[model samples]
Target: YFIIQTLAAAMILFASTLNAWQTGHWAITYPTCPLTTTIITTAIMMKLGAAPLHLWYPEIMQGATLNTALIISTWQKIAPMSMLYMMHKNLPTTLVLLTGLLSTLIGGWAGLNQTQTRKILAHSSIVHMGWLLIALAMDTALATLTLALYILMTTAMFTSLNTTSTKTITDMGTTWSASPTLLTLSMLTLTSLGGLPPMTGFTPKLLILNDLSMNHLLPLATLIALATLPSLFFYVRMAYMTTLTTPPTTTNTKYT
Candidate 1:
């Protein structure tokens, strides 16, 4: 991880120096500098934990406390994403699209078999990053909205899970005894995180897809939409565990 961080910083620094030398400004002004732009974008992708370069993020999140994981999944991505947002005009659109799509797919499919809640949320963060990237590729304003909504939903998830001290899916099954109200709200938050309709979380996704289609990106939008299904499944499964899943029924123990 240290090596990865060092490499990313070095790449970004080199790319920034090159861009500044060519344009006399330090904020990625040279849109035509493909090599520099790609290097800088890739470095940001690494920092943001977007896929093809996201393996470290989940593992790190898994080991952190709930508060630490909350910050990791929410606050940590902000600066890197801000960089991407600022450089969207110079970024290779195709590379961004491909990476974003791959993130959604990887985050969704890999998370399907996970039992650990933190790992699941890590994947969820990756999936959200994919959407945010797609939005950035099309419109930075929409990407900003996606980031805000993601922070809201992710914070809610971490707070609810923390309230019950849940670390795994099995732990969710027992949360009712800790705080039943929070358990119920946690179910709603899961659905919102999944971007299901009528939930606030769904709003950004709907607007992003609509914008993508308006910009003639239907194929990309369709693929991203399909990629969300697996994630939604896992979210629903967690919701069920939180709300409806029942423990073994103990018979009338008067006889025992």
Candidate 2:
């Protein structure tokens, strides 16, 4: 991980230097909207596990401990957003729109079959990034608010999970019976994750859709928002499995 981060930093420095030299500006002014920028940005976003480049996230999450997965889900994931913000104006609206829509669709659909908890969250992050991409494209105050809200919500969720002692889904067997309060909170968190109404998660998605619709992007907004349903379905399924399913005979009665 240290090596990976070091290499990533070096590559980013090189890329920034190249962009600045070519554009005669320090902010990546030149070729930001060209094929070069798109390829680089897309590749970086992929490395960060955002949509279209999201395949790595789930696999990595599965390999890591829950706390490590939480770190990846929160702090590490924000790099792409920062990169997008830096070259905000340079991103093509059409490309942003397409990537956002595709991410939501694929993330949601692929999450359906996943039984592992970490993989579920990995895909959920991809779905959320879809909304984030849409907000970035819209470039409105409301969109900005939505993005901030999303970051906050995700952070809160990660913190809550990190505080838990259980390291895997199997460790959480019959968790509700042992700790009903935590179980309820877990349900609430997952519900929020799916962007259900009244939760912090839903707020941003709603705001993004409204902003897009007001800007005459109703069809696109509707489609992207609807694409979230598949991810939502699986989240709901996980919630049910955790709470509704009968406990296994081997299930321990304790959370730890």
Best by TM-score: 1
lDDT of 1 by residue, 129-214 (tens): 99989889888889889999999999999998888899999888888787778887898899999999899999999998999899
- Residue 221 shift from truth in candidate 2, angstroms: 1.4
Q: Each prediction's TM-score against the native?
A: 0.94, 0.83
TM-score of 2: 0.83
lDDT of each structure?
0.90, 0.72
**Model 2: per-residue lDDT, tens digit, 52-163?**
7666678878899877877787777667667777777777678778888988998898888776777877888888777878888887565567667666666655554565
Candidate 2: residue 241 lDDT (0-100):
58
* Model 1: CA > 4 A from native: 29-31, 249-256
Off by over 4 Å in 2: 1-18, 29-33, 155-173, 249-256
**Candidate 2, which ten residues in sequence have the lowest lDDT sum?**
165-174
